[model samples]
Target: MKPFDYLSPGDPAEAVRSVARNPAAVFLGGGTNLVDHLKLGIVAPDLVVHVADLLPATVEDLDGGGLRIGAGVSNSALAADPRVRERFPVLSQALLSGASGQLRNMATTGGNPLQRTRCAYFQDVTTPCNKREPGSGCSALGGWTRHHAILGASEHCVAVHPSDLAVALAALDARVRVLGPDGERTVPFTDLHRLPADTPERDTVLEHGDLVTAIDLPALPPARRSAYRKVRDRASYAFALVSVAAAVEVRGGVITDARVAFGGAAHVPWRARRAERVLRGAPATEESYRAAADAELADARPLEGLDGGNAFKIPLLRRTLAATLRELVGEDAR
Candidate 1:
């Protein structure tokens, strides 16, 4: 490991100033992903600014029936909060479905959405990965691609974002509060992550010295009936091959409102806007669910690679989305 300078900033503004002054500096929160990258030689920052103590750690109720979640709140705490489980069950379920108990205990809400992809080529320094080094070329394009993107992919990169929490947030329309060198601002959670276009190395819109302070969940009543479902190779500790986070409001056997998002399908937590548009005011039936899934996946283009490709993810994602919508409407999802 390369030697580096460490700073435990007493204030968030101080932390921002310290990191903004030096582009080579990075803010450290929980050190779950960043530490691993440090040891793997993926990232070697000159300065590490610890912000765990500077950020808020409590979950507070907003006046309009929403919730203000501190960025420093652990995944375990967020999932276990009664308010979260009752008001936004999808978020809780999504958080619980990820990682493990020990990791959840240490992982912060702010840091969870900022996680990098688990693409094997991107992690192996010996391999050529566009995401690791932009112009070096993409190994996933011709290598193992069972976990790669099927939607919104470009020639530069096909890796998928690995964040269950982010999918739930995208469905809930949560907003992220960030403090940076330019000062404070709020960003829609859906816009937090950027698709890998020409610049595959940049994962998010966040700039240097930008610190996520908290996440704001809106007063979404439909989310009370929401749920998160993941289909993976294993029961635990495995990233989703296809995951769905959905919230539906049904009245008199018709869908009044709906929100849907998919994970492991694209470079970002893909908000199924087309599917949501189809679901609104539609009948709450399997036919309607299938239609919604079809509308969203009409343009999906799965890639071919050494591991026989990930063409299977397209159908698997369609089935997963349809089943999740069925389950939400109290139907037999099977």
Candidate 2:
């Protein structure tokens, strides 16, 4: 890693100011993702501002029955929290399915969503990657496209976001509390990450010195039946090929409410608004679930085959969503 100046700010405001003043300064949470970038030469920040100590580390109940998860709270702690497990089981399951026990212990809730794509080209400094170095051209567009984006991807970039927690958060209608140079503000979790438009370098809407203070999960009664399903190449320490985070509430054999978010399919956690719309007011059955999946996947534009392309992800995601919804309705998903 390159030599860089380090500062442990006394307060959140000071930390924000320190990073805001310097364009090449970055906030360090648990350093799980940032540290890898440093070693791989993907990022060479002039200054590393430590904010884990300054930010809140505990999970607290909100006034409206929701939960405010601290930015510094580790993934393991959040997943193991009784309240989170009881109410928002999808969030807990997503967290546990990511990384491993040791990495989860060091990964924070704030940093998890901020982690960039696992695209091999992005990590290799030698390769031409628009996301790593804008205007350099994307190497993944025609090479090893099996893991690239199928939706919300432009010609400049086709990489997908790699955050299981963010997918769950997007499905649950969670909000992000940020402390930046402009002061504090809250943003919807779905809007936190951005699609790879012309500005593929910018992964999120957050500006410089914007520190994610906490993630607020609104009280979702239907989330009790929520679940997260990740399909990967391996059983452990692998990114998802197609993942689904879904919540469905059934009343009198009819779906009253629903939320669905897809990972490993787009530049951001894809909130399946169309699927949710199709699910609500529909009967809680496999056919309804498949129809909802089809409605959401109608926009999927898979990349042409390079070396065993990602066209399979389309049907895989459809079936995964159907299976997830079926499981939520207490039916045999097989």
Candidate 3:
């Protein structure tokens, strides 16, 4: 690892100031992802600004029905919170489904959103990766792409965002609060991540000196039910092959409202707006669910090769969606 200076700022202001002073500096929370990259020689920072002590260490309820999750809050603590378990079960489930218990204990809420892609090409320094080094080219394009994206992919990159919790947050319409050189600002969780267009290197919309302060989750109606389902190669300790985070409200035997987001399918937490449009006012039935799922995957462009293996994703995602909706309505009846 390269030698670097370190600064442990006491507060948000100090942390921001420290980063602003040095353009190459990066914030350190749990060091789960950043430290790994540093050891791999992917990132060579001149300074490290520690922000673990700058924010609250737990989740708090805001004045309104919303929640304020401090940036320093650990994943284990957030998943175990009673309020989260009762109100936002999807978020809790997503968090618990990610990484192992030891890694979750070391991971922080602020660092989770900022984690990098797990693309093989990006991690291997010898291979070409547009994300790690822009204009160098992407090896995964014509190389092995079994775990690559099928939606929202471009010629430059086909990497998938690896956050199950982010998919749930996108479906919930959460907002991320940040403190930067220009003061505080709020960005929609969906907008925080950017697509891999021409510039695949830029991961998020956050400015150079900005620091994530907290994540604000808006309150949903009591009747609405939500859940997150992850499908991976193995039962555990594996990244999601495809994951769905869904919230549904049913009334009069029809869908009143629906929010759906998918992970392991796109460059970001993909909000299934096409599926939501199809589900609204539609009858709650297997036929309707199939229609919605078809609509969502209409524009999907699957990777080449492995024809039979890749085709199963469509039916699997549809079944997952149907099961989630059924569970939601079933819980509502109780």
What is each predicted model's overall lDDT from 0 to 1?
Answer: 0.93, 0.93, 0.87
How many clashes in each structure? 0, 0, 0
Candidate 1 local lDDT, 1-334, one digit each (tens): 9999999988999999999999899989988889999999999899999998888999999987899999999999999999999999999999999999999998999999999999998899999988988799988887899999999999999999999999999999999999989999999999999988899888999998899999999999999999999999999999999999999998878999999999999999999999999999898988888899899999999888888999998889889988888888884222
- Kindly list the per-residue Cα lDDT of model 2 for residues 1-334, writing each as its tens digit: 8899999988999999999999999999999999999999999999999998888899999876799999999999999999999999999999999999999999999999999999999999999999988899998877889998988899999999999999999999999999989889999998999998899899999999899999999989888889999999999999999999998888878999999999999999999999999989998888998899899889899997568789999999989998888788884222
lDDT preference between candidates 1 and 3, better one: 1
Cα miss at 106, model 1 (Å)?
0.5
Residue pairs with colliding backbones in model 2 are: none
- What is the clash count of model 2? 0
Cα lDDT of model 3 by residue, 58-107, tens digit = 78897656789999999999999988888888999999999999999989
* TM-score, model 2 to reference: 0.98
What TM-score goes with each of the models?
A: 0.98, 0.98, 0.95
- Candidate 2 C-alpha error for residue 152, in Å: 0.7
